[model samples]
Target: MDRRDYLARLAGVAGVGLAGCVTLPGSRVTGDDLPSVRNATTSNTSSPRPDGRLPRRGEVTLPVSRREMRSPLTRDHIPAIVDPVFGDDWDGLSLPDDSRAESTTLPGDAPVIGLTDGDRARAYPLRILDWHEIVNDTFGGPIAVTYCVLCGSSVVVDRVVGGSTTTFGVSGYLWRSDLVLYDRATESLWSQLLATAINGPLTGTELTIRPSSLTTWGAWSAEHPETDVLLPPPQSNTIRGREATFDYFIPKYRRDSPSVIGFGTDSNGLHPRSLVLGVAHGDAARAYPFETIRREGVVDDDVGGLPVVVTVAPGNTLVAYERRVERQTLHFSADGPSRLSAGATRWQRSTGAGVSGPQATHDLTRANDHPPMFWLGWSGFYPETSVYGEDAN
Candidate 1:
């Protein structure tokens, strides 16, 4: 389906019932007609200043660019799905038996913790939730956390009240139940329409909040005018992207016999993440000659969005490497199937050449006689494969 159709599906999933409906203005255009629409030119001349500090908002990369990075694959090229797709379909997509241990979560909150405060939110995997999709959180707030799968741009939005938070998924939208601020003196999801206002100004029950039950689900699409909002299938931070301090890393394609996969993350968590995957050569400590792949701008909708051509870097290639907590481990297609152990620190070879690169699927469940799911986001080239998300298989 096209972006609009995909969005419509998401709206349906929001379960707006009769109250969530709203009349959309103007004739809706097909995905084909999007090309006719022109987008404004944006400048990327503002980089971090020489003071060794970060740049101002004008200096940072824009959200559109990050969208491009997340989808190096063309959206128009995506085959229309006759039926809705969920994250559970991937099975036997990775190495047979990986001996790798569980990767440790960062000290604070898990970087890609699932937001269980909603009906739909609770149904998807935490890793899949990492990708920013329009979901009605249990808090009754119709918000979206635009986390790119490749660039790792995570931006939370109230979509109504305009209340939002950057980097970390924070907003006026509570995680308990899907509710609007305007009706209950909190804030309306419509307030999120304030462009660039990631976080809105309002709090408590004294504020007014509305529900889709009030005006149908028109409030969601009305607020986000740029693109058709959709719900993402379950995925992982490894596939899409994840937020890190000042860094939004994204994974693209791999290089060299599908040995390594590429990834990039953004500092803004909403723009192109400058990362790639390739074979490691020259510098043992820091993988050198790392080939880069295009993560953003792969899609076609936004005109002035992601303009740079995705290519491999000139002198270096990236390599296949895994982080087992404090100790880092390197792997090769020759290393057999990479598997993860219970401890979450050691990766072992399956003694079988299963799938290699980021596309390889590893079964995470041992109950079904299937190995755990695992894939390296960093690889060396085209035709590279890696498994993404959790699966009982």
Candidate 2:
């Protein structure tokens, strides 16, 4: 079956109901049209800045020279009107402390973006990110927390790029159904999935990805009770009320939604919608399927020539870490709640710290940049990725 028919059948089997039809306004060009579109230049005429300030467009000498844009999706494929501009520091950017965050009502199963820097931790609920796709906030330092509901990609990036701190806003654009963010400093457009600036000044600049956990609210709260949860921006009753009525976390939407866009079949034979945690080390990339990890509990594998262990703790919290200690690689297997064992060594899942054995005082290095994403989005960017259990299939 073709891609569309396969997804349609999958949705039917899963008993997914389609909502009201709404066509996003944009051109239907594909990757084949990217070459010609690359040659076309955006108008030099200055458009009113999102801040209402008039800055001369195309006048600033960007830090880098303009180069041919390289992406799986063409420029024309990106819709100009999919997202609405909320401008810089849009009204709802508020971060409340633990004491003040008690009033927020969130279900246990609600998905949240869990971030930790040193000892500081915070949870950015999807309910709030759905309304405000970009949250410019600081946790121990400056960072931009972003979520694209369209492609199911959640990324946390450092706000400082090239010595200067830059804030980001939703650029009201989509490339291959993924969110495109614009830096307010130079108005450079960035691809969220690719993590690189594609247009305007700073064309070649890339954002540094920080380690984050995308898991259930219950799991995060239980793991770190003192962590503050992001509440809806003050006086956002209308947006909060509408979000309450919408069930975006249903299994059908996550497992069989038609919003997924990809160029071809995954090199690995797993279903396109399969949830995978992608880990990139140097030039090597690998995807650990959620189905496999849930069953195995602990998986010891090598990616990019480094020994790593992918662990699924209680509450289904997924995390990856380098299993090397004192230059020796340790094999791991699920021992019990938040614990793993490598031979005689027992380690804690939350911190990857060895609890017992010769290396009891040692801690494993975390593969912090790894992000859990859908197979379609993961495979679309890393076509050479090897799925963990592809050989068995």
Candidate 3:
């Protein structure tokens, strides 16, 4: 079907009467409902198994029935959509040379998922991810880099599960408005936000979270010139076309949208759509609202009884690090020539490495697992989370 016809049909399905405005079934619509619109375009590019059929549900042996599987969301509410993007496993994945990348193609403000391991770094632009939500690739090691445009969640996880390295694919399912990933090895379904297998043989298994950053393409490319950026696989021109056609439909899911899923209420009174850097240390979880941090620049806080510092660097990159160095709790501030300071120590915001001071050789431990996500998704997953601000709920 043509793009216009398909979009009209999709709008009809969602009861959207206006051209640019999309309204869902509920009285209130948030970013969660925005990705659902991709369901129509997704079917056009969804990858099939090598045998030319959709992978059978429960293809892997499981102790429990598929229908009996449960997660934070109702199993019945989980819609079985078409993969539409990265079908099967690692389909359309690519490694493009950063030096060779055409900077003119990506806008400076365009979002990109940044990942680094030692000297190896890469940036996956959202323009590509808007079509394929998952990229199973190796850079210094096996890793699955994922971005759920629906939930505004970007995470990079170790591909190895239970000592066995496996690739992942989009399962064409959404749990609590988050992407559901399936391992090609066991066909086990996993939640992208929770980073845990929710069904199939590997149920309850957790994937190791890796340190990554979500920032603009210009900022990331400037920081790591040698980093390889993912480009659309030549075979997926159709997917790329669909992304362009639907570009206008994205703002409805932007930070201003009223659409939200799960616990829509923000106990801290922060806007449900506000962006925040969510930190979960042990049982303690807190959200550092970007609005406040953008104003203050740096925040010194504690999570799970461990002193920590959250810094917002130039280009709006957000990172959190443990403040304890050799068992000494050091206070930090952004008011310095280096932009970060703990006493006489100068620190680099990108690597959390001390540049100069008595602790010049020390590296601040990073709380990499903390996801910088939308307030709606973060609070939904962590209902009891505290907001880091004077007006916190």
Candidate 4:
């Protein structure tokens, strides 16, 4: 079945009686239409002056030459969500469970990217994201929740530029099989994986990645029962006449045998399609594969010379955090799958919050997983990254 049909099938799993999915009307350009789009271009005159606003075009630096970028679709082929609407009662809606159940995949089991701001949990369903790649959300300050279905990359970033908040949109461009996003205000082209502007006026500027969890909606909402979910626009907006489908892409091809639009191969045996939680710190970056973490339960390791800990829940919700507390490095182990225990202190797996012990008020500094991104997506940008099981595997 096509992607839209797939989304519609999985969204049926939600137990709610009703409520949303936003899908843009435009369709991806066929291979034949690729030639119609222009190659990316830029004119660099001086060193990049990193700041909060877009500098004039031709007055700064570019980390990559324009030759590496190509426009596959015109702007808004998959539009960005500028004014996102949320519903607190979506969980209460009666979702199609047994009646329209999927024959292959589990119903309502699609991955939902979860984030909490000001103690309010929100879910951005991938079904909607497959159509609109960027959501410029203003939950707490300004942030952009982005997903590139091709690369299996979801990036939540601080959308503040040069002290002012801005929104982002899909550029309909592709680089290294990843999404290229452009800020609506300045029109600077940003790479979703690199989180850096590759062209336009704001080249070389990097976005601050925020913390989020990529997991099944059942798992996320079960933990955050009060979570608000993004609702899709009316069916009339979908140009393809595709119904309001919800859910994420299920990996079809193998990383061992690469596809035309995927990472070719890895001599290290890391498959491009492998699901992993990746962390980049200091001068080092590493990927913690789901298989390894699911088996080990808790992994205490060091990256970039700093101590780190990784925890995974039974539902595949994962979180990473700095293992040091006030300069003291503590080795962490599993207190079951969803909690961490290190001597007298304990932390919730979904969050680094100290739930029990004298440090209950202290919060562990959140570490990066890049939202359980795929191996091909993470490794493409961090080619020198180390694998967590290099020594064990």
Identify the leading candidate in terms of lDDT. 4
Q: Rate the local accuracy (lDDT) of all candidates.
A: 0.23, 0.61, 0.61, 0.67
Q: What is the full ranking by lDDT, best candidate first?
A: 4, 2, 3, 1
- TM-score, candidate number 2: 0.70
lDDT at residue 329 of model 1 (Cα atoms)? 27
TM-score of 3: 0.70
Off by over 4 Å in 1: 1-26, 29-58, 61-133, 138-345, 348-393
Comparing 2 and 4 on TM-score, the stronger one = 4
**Candidate 4 local Cα displacement, residue 204, angstroms:** 2.9
lDDT string, candidate 2, 31-78, tens digits: 343344345464233344587654421223222222322233322221
lDDT of 4 by residue, 8-87 (tens): 33223210111011123244344555543244456443353477444432223355555665555667656567777777
Superposed model 3: Cα runs more than 4 Å off: 1-104, 235-267, 336-338, 390-393
Error of 4 at 120 (Å): 1.3
Model 1, global lDDT? 0.23
Instruction: lDDT for model 2, please.
Output: 0.61
Candidate whose TM-score is highest: 4
lDDT (Cα, 0-100) at 56 in candidate 4:
36
Model 3, C-alpha of 32: deviation from truth (Å)? 18
lDDT: worst 10-residue window of model 3: 16-25
